[model samples]
Structures are given as C-alpha cells and as structure tokens.
Target: MTTLNACFRGQLGDFQLDFEFSIPSRGVTALFGPSGCGKTTLLRCIAGLNFLPEGKLEVDGEIWQNGKQFMPTHKRPIGYVFQEPGLFAHLNVKRNLTYGRRRAGIKSSNDNELHELTGLLGIDHLLERDIHALSGGEKQRVAIARALLMKPRLLLMDEPLSALDQDNKNEILPYLEQLHSHLEIPVIYVTHDRREVERLADHLLLLKEGSIIAKGEIGELLTRPDLPFGRAQDAVTVLDGQVRHYDARYGLSTLQIEGGTLEVPDQLGPTGVYKRLRIASTDVSLSHQEALNTTILNRLPAVIWKILPTDGPSLNILLRIGNMGEGSPLLASVTRKSVEQMALKEGQQVYAQIKGASLLGSSSTTQPRAHCMTPLIACE
Candidate 1:
C-alpha cells in the first residue's frame, strides 16, 4: 500500500516538536490530540505554511521537501479549509467557488465537475446568494465546494466544524460524509474531537506534547488496552455490520456482525445496506453467564482479552467477539467491585449486554488495508 511518510524536527519558542510517522495514502487520517499537542503545527508543515528547513515529506511518490529542497506553499497541489469559511465577502457564491478553479488553470468547459460538487455539498441552491447573506452552515458548505473545485492531490481540513453551533454542525456533517465518500485524494484532518474521528477517519493517530503516542486503524485503536484511548473514560468502539432484518411495525432493525446480531432502534436504510455502529464503554455491561428476564436487547458471547484500569475506580474490560484474532473486540467499563463480584479474568467466557438505544448507527465506507511492510523513515 502507498503511504504518506513524514519526519520533522522544529521548535516553537521553547517547545520542541520532533516526530516520524507514516499513514495510509488513501482515506481520512485524523490527527487527534489536546489543544497544545502540535496538531495544527504539523498540518501547517504539511501544507508548506510553516516551512521547516530540515523537514522531510513524501506523499505517494513525490517528495515535497528533503534537506534544503522545499516546495513553496503556492506551488503545491493542496486544498485547505479552515474553521471559518473565508469566502470572498464581495462576490456571490458562484464567483467565489469558481475563483480557485480559474486560478488552477482548469478549463472553463469543465462545468460537469462544478455541478456535481455543488450538488454533493448541497450548495447549488445558494450559488445566487451573496456571501454575507448566508448562514454559518451554508457558508462552510460553500467553502468546501470551493476547495473541491481546485482538484487537489491532497486535502487539509482544520476543525471545519468547530466554530459552528451544534445545530449548524449537525446540518453540515452529512454533506462532509458524502464528500469524503466520493473523493479519491487523501485527506489529513486535525481535530481534538473523538466523535469526528469515529464518524469519518479510516486511521487514527494519537499525539502528545509533540510526538505520536499510538497509531492504527480506528477499530483496533479503540479497543487496545495498552493505549491511552482505551483507558479514557469516554472511550468507544465502532463496529461494521450489515442490516439483516427490519420490523416496520415495532420500529426496530437487526444488524448482523461478525459474532451475532445487534438490534437497534429504527434504522431507515435498506436491509442489505452496510452500516457502522458505535458503543460507549460505559453503555456496555458484562455477565458471567446468560441470565433470564433482562431489559437489554443486545447480548453476544465473548471471551475476555484483557483488563485495564482507568483513572478512577473503574476497569476497562477488553473482550474479543469471536475465536479468531481478526474479529472485532468490545469494551465495557465497570467498577472494581463488580470485577471481584463476577470473578472476571482473561480467557473467561461472558455475555456482553448492551442497550438498544445506546448503539448510535452512522453511514460508513471502507478502505483497503495498509500493508505491515510499508517503509518507515526517520530523520533528526
């Protein structure tokens, strides 16, 4: 598999940022960390905004920087979307969207691409409106359409939804999902929000003060007992499943996964469609044996993989869904007293109980796996 390899050593005043890593060349790669974890700085380095003389970056085969050779910001094929939609205040939405395409020397006859992008972003209706008259969500959609018109090899988004209110953010998330689904170019997204990563990212990279602490697929990273994310209080695991049965009268749908079926509330999509569901660690509970007269609707047999302690008195239990190592794992958080009461240990068989309402389903797409032999290069 092709990969994006990067190595950088720089300084922002007294803070030092030094790291080397490689991620898959396709799909969304989320850079997740706290406020001061250098997520934005690294993104700038990739965009050629914060030029690092010693930085090294290779995207799919082309080298953007190596030793003294550096590509200027304007010459690189990149599209950037910031938190605020920096649309031209004096121009209509149509003019603002076409500005980048014209500057990139694209032919004016490529109206089909423009129409498709505007329709996908749901901004075709706002093309006649002035930029100052649009709402926050509409403005952001226009910005995204403008970025896509450039036909870039790489896309960089820095918290594009952070400035909007919850309602506005919800309005724009589905369009972003659709855009991600149709694009072929790789994207590097920077955010501290775990929900966004779960919703969109194919790969997850956890950053600390200035270095990467862990990196892997979204599903594998979430259930890892040795990682900080697995020990987090709000940790969650995402599973890919297909809709098996839907009862219209009772407003319930059943999804078939690797091990068993999950019954959720009201999945409107077709029965054969693929869907992804997220379950929080706190929303799941484990039982020593299957019990009768339970309110929980979903329960699957699993084997205990490992037990990890949290910051407080809770324990994060990692349970493998099936007998194979490639099967998905489930995470459940319980108090230490419950561990003693149930005698839970590694290799013990148990049932994972989950509430129907707690399983939040979302539309998701898959990508090819990254090969384990992908080269890794480091520089000082």
Candidate 2:
C-alpha cells in the first residue's frame, strides 16, 4: 500500500520536536494534541514552511525531503488552508477560486471541474459575491475550493475551523464531510479538537510536546484503554458498518459491523451503503446476561478486555464485542461501585447494552488501508 512517510527532529528556542510515522496516502490523517504540543509546527514542517535540518518527508513514494535535497514550498504540489479564510478582499469568490488554478497554469477549459467542486462545497451560489459579503463558513468554503483548484497531491489544513464561531463551524462541517467521499488526495488535518478528529479522520496521530504518543487507525486508538482517549470523559467508540436493512415503519436501520449489528433510529441509506457510528462510552452498560425485556434495543455479547480507573469514581471497561472475544472494540464507563459489586474481570463474558448511537455520516464503501507508524527512539 502507498504511504506518506515523515520524520523530523528540530529545536525552536527551548522546545524540541522529534517524531517519525507513516500513514496511508489517502483519507484524512489528523494530528491531534493540545496547545503548544507542536501540532501546527509539525504541519508546517510537512508543508516545507519550517525547514528542519534532520527532516525527511516522503508522500506516496515521492521524496519531498531527504538528506541534502529538499523541495521548495512553492514547487511542491500542496494545498494549504489556515485557521483564517485568507481570501483576497478585492476579488469576488469566482475570481479568488480561479486565481490558484490560473497560477498553476491550468486552462479555463477546466471550468466544469471548478463547477463540480463548487457544487460539492455548496459554494456555487456564492461565486458572484465579494469576499466581504460571505459569512465565516462561506468564506472558508471558498478558501477550500481555491485550494482544491490547485490540484494538489496533498492538502494541509491547520485548524481551518478554529477562527469560526460555533454556528459557522456547524455550518461548514457537512461540506467538509463531503470531501471524504470525493477527494482522492491525502489530507493532513491539524486540529486540537477531538470532535473534528472523530468526524473526519481515518487515522490518528496523538502528539505531546512535539513527540508522538501513539499513532494508528482512529477506531483502534480511540478504544485502547492504555491511551488517554479511552479514559477521557467524552470518550467514544467509532464503528464502520454497512446498512443491511431499514424499517420505514419505525424509521430504524440495521447496520452490520465487524462484531455484531446495531439498530440506529434513522434510514441511513440503501442496503450496502457504508456509514460511521459514534457510541459514547457513557451510553454503554454491561450485564452478565442479556435482558430480553429491556427497553434497550441494541445488545451484543462481549468479552471484558480491560478495566481502568478514570479521573472520577467511574471505571472504563474495554470490551471485545463477540462471544469469542474477537471482534470490534466497545467502551463502557461504569461506576467503580458497580464493578466491585458485579465482580467484572478481564476475559469475562458479558452483554453490552448500548443506549444510543449517533450516525457521524456516510463513509466511502472502500475503506483506506490502515496507517503504519515506525517506532521512534528518544532523540537527545
């Protein structure tokens, strides 16, 4: 499988950044960390904005930087979107979008491509409007469109929604989600927001103080009890499933996942359509036996994988959702008292009762290859 290989080591003032990893060359790869963890700095290094002396970046077998050779930022086929829209105040949306294409030496004959992109972003109607006349969300859509028009091999987004208010963030998320289904280029998204990672990312790179704490597929990393994400207060498990059946009378759709089936309260799509589901750890409960008379509709046999204490009086239980204990992962946050009373232990069989599960969005039927990260040694 094709991959993007990156390794960097450098110091800025008193802080140091050192890491190495490889992810699939398609789908969204999220760089997630808190402020000052060097998320943006790492992104800049990848974009050639920060030239590290000991850095090597290879995107899908093409070497951008290695040893003495380096690719200049302007020469690299990259599309960058910053926190701010960064649109030209003087130009209308149409002109602003076409500017990148024109600079890239693409002919105006590609207008059909432009129209298709604008339509996907829901920005075709705003093409005639001035930059100042657009809302925060609209302006960002235009910025995204402009970047895509460059026909980049890789796209870098450094908190593109950070400048927008909550309303604007909500407004643009759907369009951003649409890109997952349409775009073929690899996207490196930098954000501190876990919500964004859950909604958009296929792979995750967790960073802390310029170092990678963990890197893997989003689903696997999110449910690992050893990771902070699994014990987080807002921890959630993301599952990829295909719609198998829909009952219009109850407006419920049955989804088949790796381990078991889930019934969501919506008609997601026709049979065989893929969708992503988010189940909160708090919404899951475990019982030794399946309750046949319960109000809960989704229940699956699972094996207790791990039990760890959280920041509060709760314990986070990691479960493998199948009778044989070899299936997709699930997380349940239960009170410590409940665990002590039930005598739950690793490898024990139990039924996971899910109270609610939300549909993140439709996913591509063809899943991307899992990300592969090289182990890093400490750099002195």
Candidate 3:
C-alpha cells in the first residue's frame, strides 16, 4: 500500500496554495475544484516543481520534502502530464517514447512492457511521423504513453484533457478508462471537469481557493449539500447500479437501483453485473407521485432528505434513495424551483425524474466492499 501523509503551505505573488489530504494506500485520488483554485499549485508542490513556504511532502512511505529535505524535481519518481501535450518536435515519436521507456525497465520487465504500451496507445503506426503532424488527441495519447513508460509509482496529471476539443477528448477518454481499469500505479488526477472525476476517481479530495474544502469517496462527496462547489454546473449525483436486464426490443437497460428500477440509454452492458451511472442535477424533475407513461423511463419511489435553494430559478435537492441491494443510501439532485413548487419536504414521498446518465465499468459497477479508501495527512 502507498500513502501520501504530508502537508504543504505556500504563498505565491497573488495566489496561495494551502491544502492537506492523504491518498489511499492505492487507487486514483482526484483533486477537483474550479479554475485557479489551487489544484495545479498543489500538484506542482507535490512534484517538487514548486516549493511551498512551509511544506512537507511524502509518497509511498518515503519523505520527499520536509522543510530541510527538499527533493529536486528530477530526483522524484513521478510522471507529470501537463494540461497540454508538451511533445518535442525535433524528435520522432519512437524516439520520444524510448526516452521514458528506458527508465521503466528499472521497475518492469522490458521486452513486454514496451510492446504492450505501444499497442495500448495505438500510436505504433505513427511512430515514424513528426510530432507536429499529430492531432491534439494523438499528441496527448503519446504524452500519456511517454509518462507511463517511466514506470512511476505515482502519476500526476494536471488537466490533461482540458486543452483538447470534444472530438479529441472522445478520442482519448477510452485510453484513460483502460489505464484506470488495468494499471496498478497510483494516480493523482487534477481536473475541473466533473465528468472526468466521475469516470475515473476512486477517492476524491475536493479543493476550494487555497484550501481543502472537503474529501471523501467520489459518490459521497458529490451528494454533500453543504459543499460550496455542490451546486455548480458540474454538480451531479453518483449511483452504482447493476444491469439486471437489458430490453433490447425497446432499446432500454433495466438498471436495478436500491429505491427502484431506472431505464437509461442502451449502450451499457449485458455486463453480467452492473454499471456505475452519473445523473446530472438538471436532468432530474420532482413529482408528487410516481410519473406516469411518458418518454422518461425512471419513476422510482423516493424520500426528500434536504433541499438547497441555489438561486432564484433552480434549487439543489438531495434525496435519500433506497438501494435495491445491501448498502448505504444513494443521492440524487433536483432543482430548487421544483422543490418549492411541489412543496417537497423531508419524509415526503415523491417521484424523481431522471434524464442523462454515463455508464461505467465492465464488471461489478461498484467498489468490492464499500465504495473506496483514501490516505490521510496528519498536520499539526
């Protein structure tokens, strides 16, 4: 197991990066926040790229920085992927890949690792091509492959997908999923995008301006009403559901959740087990009773837990949903105007309308035990 138990505090010209949280002994721990919210600053501090005023950094049980013991950037065993793919144009793709591949041999078996990575990234055909000739997505895939070639114990990604267009993002996302599913290396992923966090984060550390606002498993954190970042456009409810059955005739998948069945888009699985789904706040509507025949498929029984009035037009409603299986409660999001108009209150029985969904995982749609685990940093 690997853990990060350290605190770093620093003040730049007009910005201050002050935050603390531990990663899991293993798995992806996402640092999520708004733009210019100290996410990248914290990342740089951990990587030894930026020195904090009073900083202490540790990874894999080893102390990398502690006031007097500041490890240089090059001395650390980390792979850094910038927001943009910073590839060297002077070198060919093969040469750039080999640059990091040589370092990986220190921890992995050489002959197979190199061949496997090339195939996984699907850049073997572009090896002979020049760097500038590649598309934004292709360049990024190469950047990721190069970083992995270093065989780092910790991978640090700073909004690696933010710079790409939608098409380019789509092109690279599958590779990220594969990376998350198969790689054993721990990753500290920094992003402002909720979708990326939902798709990849096992553990989550929520950040606000120059401080750690909250930290928890991804699904739980998103459902927290007290969170300042909770009502933004990125705010969403996370659910782990299994595909009990798929009705191909109607192009629907019967997702058996705790409270009841939810029908979502058909791309999911015969996935034998289940799929994790992300439902947006705006996608859901509130009703006094279960919804009747309409284009919407889910009309489950629910209890209103809390209502957060976000603004004049909409509200953020938190619902305590009964899981179809054994587990803790799940959360759903709805708007404020809907809450007031319906006079939704605690313990009131209501029907929730759900629209969009993003299906996750090829196997059991959730954590083996309870969601996930995270590391904690002890600070005085």
Candidate 4:
C-alpha cells in the first residue's frame, strides 16, 4: 500500500508540536482534537503556511518538506481551502475558481472540467455572481471548487465548515461526500468536529496539546478504552454492511455486517450501495431476559463482556454479539440503577436492542473500521 508519512518536531511560542503519522496514500486523513489543540497549527505546518523547526512531509514517496530543504508554499503542489472560504472580494466566482489555473506548474484548464465542477458543486448559476453576494455555504463550495480545479497532488482543509452554522454544514456534506466518492486524490482535513471526522476520515490522528495521542481507523478508536476523547462524546459504533435487501415498500434496508444481519433506514439505492451505519451506545438497550414481544426490529443476543462506570450517571458495557462472530463487539451505555436492577453481569446473556434509523452516514468512508470494513471509521 502506498503511504503518505510525515514526521516533525517544532516549538511554536511555548507550544512544542510533534506529530508522526502514516496514512494510506488515498482518502481523507482527519486531524481531530479539542479547541486550541494545535489541529490547525499542524495543518499549517504541513501546508508550509507555518514553518516548523525540524519537519518532514512526504506523500507517496515525494518529499514536500524536510529540516532545511523545505519547499516553499508557492513551489510545492498543494490545494488549500481555508476555514473561511477566503475568496477575493474583488473577483467573481468564476474568476476565483480560475485564478489558480493561470499559476505556474498548472498545465492547462479544460472547459469541460470547469463546467463539471461548477455543476457538481451547484454553482453553475452563480458563476457570474460576485463573491460577496454568495451565502456562506455557496462560498465554501466555490472555494472547494477552486482547490480541486488546481489539480494539486494533495488537498488540505482546515475546519472548512466551522465558520458555517449547522444548516450550512448539512448543505455542504453531500457535496463533500460526492467529492470523496468521485475523486481519488488524498485529503488531509483538520477539524475539532467529531461528526465531520466520523463521516469523512479514513484514518484518525488524535492530537492533544500539540502532540499525537492516538492514531488509528475511526471504528477501532471509538470503542477503544485507551483514548479519553473517543469515549467523551456519545460513542457511535460504525458498521459497514452491504444493502442485502432494501424493502422500499416497507422503507427499510437489510444489511449484513460481520456475522450478523441488521436493519436500517432504506436510504440507499440498490444492492451494491455500501453503508456505514452508526448505532449510538445510548440508543442501545440491554435486556437480561429474552425479549419476545419487543417493538424493536433488531434484537440480537449478546454476551456480556466488560461493564465499566461512565463519568456520567451511566454504565458503559461491552457486548459480544451472538451469532455475529466471536470476539467482534458492540457497545451499550445504560443507567447504573438499571444495570443493578437487572443484575447485569459478565458471562450473562442479553439482547441488544438496536434501532434501524439510528445508523448514521451515507456510508461513511473515512471513519474507523473493525476489519478495515471498506475503510470507514475515522473520516475527514
């Protein structure tokens, strides 16, 4: 497998940043952490926007940065889309996108490629409009178009959606997913938003105080007890399954994951539509006895594994799925009172109630995976 590995160590004003990670030569590599966690600073260093003391950046065997022989930002081939859509107010949308076309090293512009990008981003009608006249979402789309139009070897995005509100983020997610599905170019996305990382990153780089804390696929890290951040938020177990059967009339999709069959919302088209479903631990419920008449469609029998105390007024229990293959696990968080009331214990049998619609993602590709399940786990 082609790998893009980077090793660097630098001190930025009292902050010493040291990050070393090797991501697959393709797909999104998400840099995730809390606010003021040096996610952006590291991204800048990689982009040559911020010069580090002793840094090295390599992509698919091409050296972009080293200790003293660092390549200038203008000289290196990188397409950067900043946090705020940094469009030129004086230029129109079309001009902003085509600006990089005239830059050195860019061979030529194909009218068809430009038209396709405009169409894909839903900016064909706004090409003639001024930058200031566009909405935040539109501006971001244009900025992304500009970056892709340059045909850089790698794409860098630093919290591209943070400036926008929730509605705007939703408006742009489909476009971002389309870009990932269609293009083969590698992307390094920096964000504090767990949802964004969960939906987009093929590899997860956990940063804390300007250093890497943990690095792995999204799925593996979510249930991992080693990392504090992965368990901080409501833990969502991502599952990749083929749309075994989609009953359009009933509005449900039967998915096969690992050794079990699951039912989720019928959002996919045909059979080949790979799906990444998120089942939050909170949404899952455990029953000590057999559930014969439960309304929940998914009630797979599970064996109790590790039951631990959560920081909140809850208990996080690790479950070994029955008939879903040995050792493969699922997570459930329930109240301590409920656990004691039911006398939940290890080696006990229980049914895991999973909702069909609780599964999130339009087939999340970048996030973590159990068996490298189509490489969906820690995503962009």
Candidate 5:
C-alpha cells in the first residue's frame, strides 16, 4: 500500500514538536487540533518551507528530505492552498488557474482535465471573472483548481474555508467532496473543526501541543472510547449509505446502510444519492430488549463489541450489527448507572436507539471500509 512517512523533531519559538506518523497516499488526511497546536507549522515542514535538519519526509517511495539532503519548496511536487485564496488581484480566474501549470512547465493540449476540474469545483462559469470580483468561496474554489492544475503528487490545504462565512462554507464543501471523488492524490487538510474533519477526512491525525495524540480512520477514532474525541458530547459516527426510499408526504428519506435502514429528513436529495450520515453518540440510547411502542425511528439490533470507560460518569460502548467486521460501528454514550441497570457487557446483545433528527447528512463519495489504516506514531 502507498503511504507518506514523516518524522520531524523541531522547535518553533516556545512550541516543541517531536513525532512521526504515516498516512495513506490517497484521500484526505486531516491534521486536526486546537489553535496553537503546530498544524500549520507541520504542514510547512512537509512543504520544505520550514527546513528542519532532523526532519525526514517521504511520499510513496521518493525521499524528499532526510538529514543533510533536502528538496527546495518550489522543487517539491506539492500544491499548497492557504486560508486565503491569495490570487493575483489583476488576473482573471482563467489566468489564475493556468498560472500554476505554466510555472510548472507542464504542457497539456487537452482541456479535458481543466474542464473536469472546473466543473467539479463549480467554477466553470467563474473562469472569466476577475479574481477581485469573486466571493470568498468562489476565490477558494479557484485556488483549489489552480493547485490541482499543477499536477502535484501531494496537495496541502490550510483551512481553505476558515475565512468564509457559513453560507460560503456550505457552497464550497460540495466542491471539495467532488475533489475527494475525482482525485487520487493524497491531501493533507489542516483544520480545527470536527465537522469538517467528519465530512472530508478518510484518515485522521489528532495533534495536540505539537505532539500526536492519536491517528487512525475517522470512524474508528471517533468510536475508540479511549480517545477524548470519541467521548465528547458532540462525538458522532459517520455511516455511509445510499438513498433507498423517499417519502414525500411525510418528508422523510430512508438510507440503506450496511446493517439497517436509516430514515433522515427528506430534503437530503433524490433517491440513490450517496451520503455520509452523522449519528451523535449522545443521541443514541441503549436497551436490553427492543421496544415496540417507542417513538424512535431507527432501532438496530447490535451486539456489544467493547465498552470503554470515560473520564466521567458516562461510558462509551461500541456496538456491532450484522457481520461484526462489516457493520458500521455505532457508538452509544450511556451513563455508568445505565450500564449496571442493563447488565451490558462485551459480547452481550443490545438494541441501539437513534433519533431521526440526530442523523446529519453530508457529501460522501467513498465506500465504507472495514477500518481505517493509519499507522500510529509514538510520541516522547
């Protein structure tokens, strides 16, 4: 399997970073942490902007840096997108998009890639507009397109939507989803928002205080129970499903997932559209037996896979339905008192109750995997 290996030990002023980790070579891997956690610093290290003598970097099999050997930033096969578009104010969108390709000395007579990229970003119509005339979201889309045109082996995005308002952020997210589907190059996306991490990340790298706390698949990390991310009140599990049925009169949409059907709000989209559903652990309730008179819409028969102890009064349980290996892992956060009342234990069967309103939908392009395979790195 392809992978990007990174080992860096450095200090930026008062912050110290020492860790090594590997991420899959395709799909988005989010560098997530708090505001001062060295996310951007690490990103710059990978791009060769912040040269560290002790750093080591390798993508696939190519060595970009190690010891005394180092590749310059411009020479490295990387495309970087910052929080702001940073496009030339005097240039038109078309010009801005082509500048990277031209600078890279890449020649392509085929407008196929260009058309496909622009179409994926919803910027085909904006190509003729000047950079100054575009909205924040539009400019970011243009910036992303420009980076793609460079045909780099890796893409680095630094909070591309951080500067945009909610309306604009929503406008550009679908386009980012399209990139996830259409491109095979690896992406290192930096952000502090868990929502963005849930929607876009295939692999997750949790950085804190310049060190790695945990790194793995988003789903696995979110339900690990050992990680604080899994026990947070807003902790959620992402389920990949396709629209199975639509109820117009009741305004409900049913999604067919691996183990069972999930009924969400109907306005999600037409039948057959794939979506990533977010089910919060807090919204899930557990029962020893299935109830018939309950008002809850989604109830799945799950076997307790493992129960994890939280720092507080609550416990996080990982439940599996259907084939344990193939089923989407459901995380239910329940009180320790409830655990004693229900006599819940590993290997015991239970019912998972999920509310319809708790199911949040987002753009999904990839199929659900049995597990994410990000190699864990030990921190000193």
Candidate 6:
C-alpha cells in the first residue's frame, strides 16, 4: 500500500515537536489542533522548509529526506498553499496560473491541463481577469489551480481558509470538496476548524502541545468515546452511505450505511451515488422501545456501547446501530435525570431516534456541488 511516512524530532526556540506516523498517499489528512500546537510547523517540516537533522520523510516510497541525504524544497514534488493567495498583482489570472508551469519547465500541453483545472475550480471564466480585481475566494481558487498546474505528488495546505470571511469560506468550501473527491494526490491540511475536518478529511492527526494525541480514520476518531472529540459538548458522528433508492413522491432518498439505512430528505443523487452524513449527539434521542405515535421518522435498534459523563449536566451515550451491536456507531446526549428515568445502561438495547442529520458532500461529483443542510426527517 502506498503511504507517506514521516518522523521528526526537533526543537524550535523553547518548543519541541516529536511525532511519527504514516497515512495513505491519497485523500485529505487533516493536521488538527488548537493554536500553538505545531500544525504549520510540522507541515513545513514535511515540505523541507524547516529541516531537522533527526527527521526522516518519505512520500509514496520516494525518500525525500533521511540522515544521509536531504531534498531541497523546490526539488521535492510538492504544492504548497498558504493562508494568503499570494497571487501576482500585475498578472492576469491565466498568466498567474501558467507561471508555475513555466517555472517547472512544463511543455505546451499544460494549456489543455490548465483549462481542465480552471474549469474544475470554477475559474475558467476569470482567467482573463486581473488578480487584483478578484474576490478573496476567487483568488484562492486561482492559487489552488496554480498549485495543481505544477503536478505535485503531495499538497500541503496551511489553513488556506483562515483569512477568509464566512461568506468567502462558504463559497470556497465546495471547490475544496471537489478537489478532495477528484484529485489523487495526498493532501496534508492544517486547520483548527472542526467543521472543515468533518467535511473534507478522510484521515485525522490530532496534535496537542507539539505531540500527537490521536491519529486514525476521521470517522473512527470523531466517535471514539475516549477521545476529546467524542466527549465534547457538540460532538457528532460522520457516516458514509450510498443512495439505494429515491422516492420522488415524498422527496426522500434512502441511503445504505454500514449496518442500516437512512432516509435523507434530499435527493442526493441517482442510485449508487455516495454521500457523507453528519449526525450530532444532541440531535439524537433514545427510547427503550420504538414510539409508534411520535413524529420522529428515523428509529433504529441500537445497543448501548458506552456511557460517559460530559463537561456539562448531560451524559454522552455511545450506541452501536444494529440488532446485535455490529454496525456503525451513533452518539446520543441525554440528561442524568433521563438516564436514571430510562434506566439506561451499557449492553442494553434501545432505539436511536435521529432528530436530524446534515448531508455534507458528494463523493462522485467532478465539480463543486452545493452542500445540502436539509434535515434527515424520515427512515425505513
């Protein structure tokens, strides 16, 4: 299996960063943590900008750095996108994009590739516009396209959206999602935003105080009761499901998940199309038996996996969604009084009534798709 292996031990000022891990060479791997946690520092290390003598880095079997040899930043096949767009103010958008290809000594065939990339990023129409006239989101899209024009084996993004306002962030997110679904290059994204992690990342590396607290698949890490994410007050579970059926009459699509089916309110796509789902703990409720008269439409049998106290008055309940507790996990937050009133306990079987869910993004789209915030209101 292709993987990127990295190990670094270094000291910068009074702070020390020591960590080692390997992730797949495709999909987005988020370097997630709070401020001053060494996310950007680690990214720079991987890019050869902050070389450490004790560090070793490999990308898909190529040794970029080792004790015996060190590859320079420009020599390594990498695309770096910083917080700022860094576009040339005097250049047109098309000229700015072609500059990278020219620097890399790419041939005239880059014209066709550039056209395709610009179209994918929704910047083909803006190719003739000057960089100075573009919006924040538009400039960032051009920056991303310019990076891709160089055809890098790995991409490093250091909080590319941190400088944008909410409107621009929202405008650029779908384009980022398109890149995540369509590109084959591995991306190391540094960010402190949980929402961005939920929507874009396939793998996660959680850092705290310059040390790795957790590293694994994003879905598993987000729902593990022992992790900080699962214990947080606004914790949520992410699930990937395929559209099995769509009812045009009621405007609902049935999504087949790991161990069950969910009736999402939107027509996600044709059958067999895949999409991501986000279910918050607060949006889920529990009952000993399925309520027949309630307005809730999503009620699935689940077995209690674990129960833990939260930082607030409520407790976090982890449930395995299946008859024998052999399926996808779900989280439900309920008060201590309700837990006592319902006699909830580990290993007990109950029903998970999902109050709502958000459709994050599509896995099959070549271009950006508008995210659906439609609440999941029914299931069968």
Query: Which run of 10 residues does model 5 get worst, by summed lDDT?
Result: 369-378
Report the C-alpha lDDT of model 6 over 1-380, residue by residue, as the tens digit.
Answer: 44678888778667798878776757888999999999999999888998777778887678888854799998988899999999999899999999888878977743778888898899999999988889999999999998988888999999999999999999999989877877877889999999999999888899999988888878878889889888988999988777889999999999877678899897898887778899999999999998989988888889999997889999999999998888888899999999999999999999999999898864564222222111111111
Best by TM-score: 2
Per-residue accuracy of model 2 over 89-110 as CA lDDT, tens digit each: 9999999998877777877665
lDDT of 2 at 94: 96
Kindly report which residue stretches of model 4 are placed more than 4 angstroms away from their true locations once superposed: 288-290, 320-329, 341-343, 346-349, 359-380
Order of quality (lDDT): 2, 6, 5, 1, 4, 3
- Candidate 4, 8: how far from true, in Å? 1.1
Cα distance off (Å), candidate 5, residue 164: 1.2
Candidate 1 local Cα displacement, residue 320, angstroms: 1.4
Q: Which 10 residues in a row give candidate 1 its minimum summed lDDT?
A: 366-375
Higher-ranked by TM-score: 1 or 6: 6
Q: Itemize residue pairs with steric clashes in candidate 2.
A: none
Q: For model 2, what is the error of residue 286's alpha carbon versus the real structure, in angstroms, after optimal superposition? A: 0.7
Instruction: Quote each prediction's TM-score.
Output: 0.91, 0.95, 0.84, 0.88, 0.87, 0.94
Task: For model 1, state the Cα shift of residue 300 in Å.
Answer: 1.2
Task: Give lDDT for model 2.
Answer: 0.87
What is the Cα-based lDDT of residue 60 in candidate 3? 74
List the candidate 5 regions with Cα displacement exceeding 4 Å. 242-274, 295-297, 305-316, 322-326, 335-340, 345-347, 357-366, 369-371, 374-380
Candidate achieving the largest lDDT:
2
TM-score of predicted model 4? 0.88
Off by over 4 Å in 6: 362-380
lDDT, candidate 3, 102-162, per-residue tens: 5545555454776688777778788889998999999998998888888777899999999
**Worst lDDT 10-window in candidate 4:** 371-380
lDDT of 1 by residue, 320-359 (tens): 8754423578888989999999999988888888753244
